[model samples]
Target: MLEVGSTLPEVSFGYIKDGKMTDPRTNEIFGDKRVVVFAVPGAFTPTCSQAHLPGYVALADKIKAKGVDTIVCLSVNDAYVMDAWGKASNAEEIMMLADGNGFFTKSIGMDMNTSDFGGTRSVRYSMLVEDGEVVKIFVEDPGRFEVSDAETMLKNL
Candidate 1:
């Protein structure tokens, strides 16, 4: 996994914004900004829908108050699904990014293989990125949601 002091990989991911598909590169979003990025295995899955994304959605304002320029929810899903999930969660303040092919997740060494579940998915993780470099990272253990919660990240900030 990408650790502290590692620069985020140069990758572009698409998302729906204002009814249009918007693809933004990592630099465009993380450069010159304090960004909090959290990745999930898939969208609308049990833990992610019930807790993970909701936690961030609920604490987004508080997280941003701590000098965070953006709070992003990333998943290895397509733009349409991501957009729908964000809307369903009432996550207007959070940026929902779709890593359609898991490229970004693989690039950061956070991708995991789930043969019976999903083909390839991202491991649950969160990071504090500033100016395109990771300042802090929290990666959850397999099948766990202990460390990468929004509350923990907020407390760290």
Candidate 2:
């Protein structure tokens, strides 16, 4: 698992931004920026939809006020699903990123799969990264949610 103070892995994946397909690495999305990146097992899942993304949306202003540049919500789904979920959840302040192949999640050593889910997915995790280095992490236990809430992340900031 990636630990605090570790340099974040160099990973990139496709995502939908403003209805356009984008590659984050090519865009240098995290370079020289203070970022809050959170991942969930899947898009539109119950806890992730009701709590995780909304928590970040509700705290978007406050997070920006604290000097954070972006709050990103990543999932193992494709860009279309991520875009749809963002629209449905009204996650205006959060950038919904798609790690379609679990590349980013696996690079960070946070990929897992539940017995029932039957596929590799990102564990519920949140990290505060500064210039591509991790400053803090909040990783939820498998099958558990809530520890990585935006409120807690804001408090940490």
Candidate 3:
């Protein structure tokens, strides 16, 4: 798996903004920006919906205050789902990115599958990327949720 200090993989993915579909890489979204990218297994799942994403949402301001250019939530789901979940969670400060085909997740070596769930999904992880290079990583153990919280990442900032 890609680790802290590794250069983040180059990949393009879709996101819904203002009800329109957009591509981040081609749009040059984070090319010169310092971004916080967090990935969850799926959208609207229990831990992800209730805890993982909310932590980032709650600390979005603090993270941005520390010079972060943006906070992004990535998941191996479609853009529509991400958009809906972002709205439902009240995550206005975070860009919910959709890795619909798992291409981005696989490129980072963080793709996995739960037998019960039945398909490829991103492992629970968080990264601080600056101009496309990973500066820090917080990868949680499978089914474990302690290491990748926003508070920890904030402290690292």
Candidate 4:
């Protein structure tokens, strides 16, 4: 797993904007910026939909007030699903990013195999990045959601 002081990998995360696909590289998003990034195993899953992403959406303004340039919610789903979920959740202030194939998740060593409940997926985690380097990271254990929530990230900031 990526640790504090580790730079984010060079990879592209897909999303939808204005009805078109946008794939931004990791550096483009994290470089020269303070960003809050959180990842879920899949989009629209129970905990993710009900608590994980919604917490960020509710606290986005406060998080950005602490000099965070962006708040990203990432998942191992397609752009279409992520976009839809963002809209459904009223997450206009958050960036909904799609891993699509778990490439970025695997590259960061946060990938897990579930066998039945969606195959390869990313474990739940949240991080604070500054100028492309991780300054703080909170990774949740299997089936747990304690340390990686928005309130925790906000308090840490």
What C-alpha lDDT do the candidate models reach, one value each? 0.95, 0.87, 0.89, 0.95
Q: What is residue 102's positional error in candidate 3, in angstroms? A: 0.3
Give candidate 2's root-mean-square deviation (CA, Å). Answer: 1.4
RMSD of each: 0.7, 1.4, 1.3, 0.7
Off by over 4 Å in 2: none
lDDT rank order: 4, 1, 3, 2
Residue by residue across 22-85, what tens digits does model 1's lDDT show?
Answer: 9999999999999999999999999999999999998998999999999999999999999999
TM-scores of the candidates in the order shown: 0.98, 0.94, 0.95, 0.98
What is the TM-score of candidate 4?
A: 0.98
Better of 1 and 3 by lDDT: 1
lDDT, candidate 4, 78-150, per-residue tens: 9999999999999999999999998999999999998798999999999999999999999999999999999
* Local accuracy of candidate 3 as per-residue lDDT tens digits, 1-157: 8876777667788899778998777236567889998899999999999999999999999999999999999999999999999999999999999989989899889999775784999999898888877889999998899988899999999
Off by more than 4 A, model 3: none
* Local distance difference test, candidate 4: 0.95
- Over the stretch 1-157, how does candidate 2's per-residue lDDT look in tens digits? 8899888767787778778998787137677999999899989999999899989988999998999998899999998999999999999888888899888888888889755774888999898988988899999987787679899899999
